[model samples]
Target: MRKKGAYQQYKDVQIKTANQGKLLLMLYQGCIKFLGLAIKCINDKDFEGANNYLQRARKVINELMSSLNMQQGGEIAENLAMLYEYMNHQLIQANIHKDTEKIKFVKKLLLQLLEAWQEIINGSNTEENIDTNLSINI
Candidate 1:
């Protein structure tokens, strides 16, 4: 097998070493990226490319939903699971119809969630009571 590229190796290390909070942020960023790419593909009339990107975004959302710690997260996890399901459905419709607007809406929601996650992670890091390494499982 061919050796991994430098960037690939770096990403591997990053993922391996990241705390649960960081991993969650990475998932959100990745989903937003895929959604943006899908929008661009739709604008360029590349339905196949759009479908591929939307599928990738859906996978990320699924991963996020699966990672949630429902027992500990309580109502928050339940709400997030519902939202993720909605986003996945929107992505499916967007892929079928080649709808840039729907993709844009999903991207907007992801961005908002990313910002909130970032703040939560940052705030938690600043507090000594919170363990950065603790698995929130999100």
Candidate 2:
């Protein structure tokens, strides 16, 4: 296999080994990365490239929306669904207008959301570590 094919396989295996929380984190980060790339493409007058990146970002947002478990997640899931929908609409407008500012706005929102998720995951890890270090004697 080619070098790119090997790298892709490695990435797939890494993702497969990650838990759901990490997968969600990766999706948010991927969306932000694509949005940033689209912004740069727009700055360089590469509308076609910008549109491609924006479309990729939209796909990530769609995946995030679809992964939400409304019944179990409650208000949080509903709010995330609305945010994802709004981001998709903004991306559509950005693609149509070739607006770099809108892409920046959306990237900022994704970064903020990603940070929130990171905190939750980090806190969970800390709690787990603390529990593991504790000793209970009967």
Candidate 3:
């Protein structure tokens, strides 16, 4: 409640924000790796590796889903939901037919998603410097 004590509060918030950003970076990295592995497996015609990547991706996705709150309003939530739906469909179709081409297509789509997300992720670095007191949770 005191103005002089606000500095510690501000520092705490910055640390928390940094931690969340790191978590997101980890998520994105995981997705990228899964997609890479899937693409590799597809190119090599390794159905087993492709399946393994899909399972790993599912685990990464589960962590990201925890941030979604369907009962509340969120622009990010809506966008991610749409992406998830599309990704799910593509992944299932690829798996069903054991199709390498289809898996490659889906991997491309995921790459685009990662590139877009990277902009925001990298932007966080710049943001942290100018707005140390700001907090963003994703």
- Strongest candidate by TM-score: 1
Q: Report the lDDT tens digits of candidate 2 across residue range 38-81.
A: 99999999999999999999999998888776765677778888
**TM-score for each prediction?**
0.91, 0.86, 0.62
Q: Which is the better candidate, 2 or 3, if ranked by lDDT?
A: 2
RMSD to the true structure for each prediction, in A, is 2.5, 7.0, 10.7
Cα lDDT tens digits for candidate 3, 1-138: 556578878866755765554556566667768867877887789989888887687666665665555545267667776776676677777776766676566567667766765566566666553233222245
Model 3 misplaced stretches (Cα beyond 4 Å): 1-18, 69-73, 125-138
Clash counts for the predictions, in order: 0, 0, 0
lDDT, residue 123, candidate 1:
74
lDDT of 1 by residue, 23-134 (tens): 8888999999998888888889888888899999999999988887777667887899999999999989988888889889999999998998777777784432233322
Estimate candidate 2's alpha-carbon lDDT, on a 0 to 1 scale. 0.82
